[model samples]
Target: MGAPQHEDVDTVDVDLYDPGDGSIPVFRWRQAGQALATRRQLREMGLRPGGQSPVARIECRGGRRFAWLYRIDLAKPKLPMTLAKELALDKAMAARQTCPKCGRRYHHVLPLKTLGSCLECHDGTPADPASYVTSAPAHRLAA
Candidate 1:
């Protein structure tokens, strides 16, 4: 086996970390393969070039939406996985709330500090976030 080869550095500014970097440099780059897709395409497939937001943005062109900008941080494995999990957890939080002691459930905006243990669990108990486990699966499915 030999060392892997990498393409020459492609220094396009990432969307989340960068605002617009002027269209000229981006336009002149001569897209090697098929050009990266528009945000619409990515949204349809649920893949963001930069990943998801709090770090991704919807960019517009000519008054119509163009593409998604992602943070380079999204490319980091740890952050991407964490974001995916958070998104899933947010969806779950939106879905329902639970009583940790009785396992009965309810619906409400869960307190951020009480993410793991529900209101019932922490009733007169210490709010030790470290001791709790999220109800979310260990690995969340990408939306």
Candidate 2:
């Protein structure tokens, strides 16, 4: 069987958004390069646009999908990860691992909606001291 022919939906005119007039030009897919870089591309190079606006954009899939492009010359180096930020992230994760009912930290994530507590706390059989006292012998209770 022969491959089906697809209609071209991405036919935006590059002249409409002229790059010469300092305006952001919108090029077709795989066409925005040489002078521009996407966000992921910049990240791969350990660079960022800093605060500069996009120099252009790549539009595709009938203009439904678009990726903003920034000038490589204008991009800045990415900042280093700090110890303070790492510690804060660790604290946030620790809080999520702690069970509310048992006041204990669990290795695995607990189901908040279904269990709502630790496995021991949510079980059908009671495991508390009060339950043991109630189920004591009748003669012991009378004494």
Candidate 3:
């Protein structure tokens, strides 16, 4: 039998569908061929889509969850983390984890939005010493 024609439905069998109108094919979980991989899968393989558009989609749980599939052959190697990127990310995280009132940087993120400070600074809850750095980092990122 011939492949099924493209339709507007959500789920379609990859093997039985032919995308002649530039529409992306859809496949059930585990049915997408080895040549195709989702973003997370590509990341696990140390690859990125490299600006290529998705060639297909995979759906599971009756189409409630889906991921875009990219051509593995066209994927590029994942970029390595640089020292500057690491420092920048740490600086961003510092803003969230630091307490403005007490100058204490907690190991976990503080309730900055609602309380505007860490638990101890917010209501004198006596935060554990182990939970936060003794003091904020000495150096600050340049504005």
- Best candidate, lDDT: 3
- List ranges where model 3 is wrong by over 4 Å: 1-22, 83-143
RMSD in angstroms, candidate 3? 9.4
lDDT of 1 by residue, 24-143 (tens): 223212131233444445445555555444333343342133333444434323336678999999768644554444343445544545456466455655534443344554444444
When 1 and 3 are scored with TM-score, the better candidate is: 3
lDDT by residue (tens digit), candidate 3, 1-143 = 87886654554333435554546777788899799999999999999999999998888876656889999999999877686789999999989999888778889999899999999878899999999987546753333
lDDT of each model, Cα atoms only? 0.44, 0.66, 0.83
> Which residue segments of model 2 deviate by more than 4 Å?
1-22, 82-143
Best-fitting candidate, scored by TM-score? 3
What TM-score, computed on C-alpha atoms, does each candidate reach?
0.23, 0.43, 0.45
Root-mean-square deviation (CA) per prediction: 15.7, 13.1, 9.4
Better of 1 and 2 by lDDT: 2
Ranking by lDDT: 3, 2, 1
Model 1 alpha-carbon drift over 4 Å, by segment: 1-33, 51-143
By summed lDDT, the worst window of 10 consecutive residues in model 1 runs over 24-33
Error of 1 at 69 (Å): 7.2
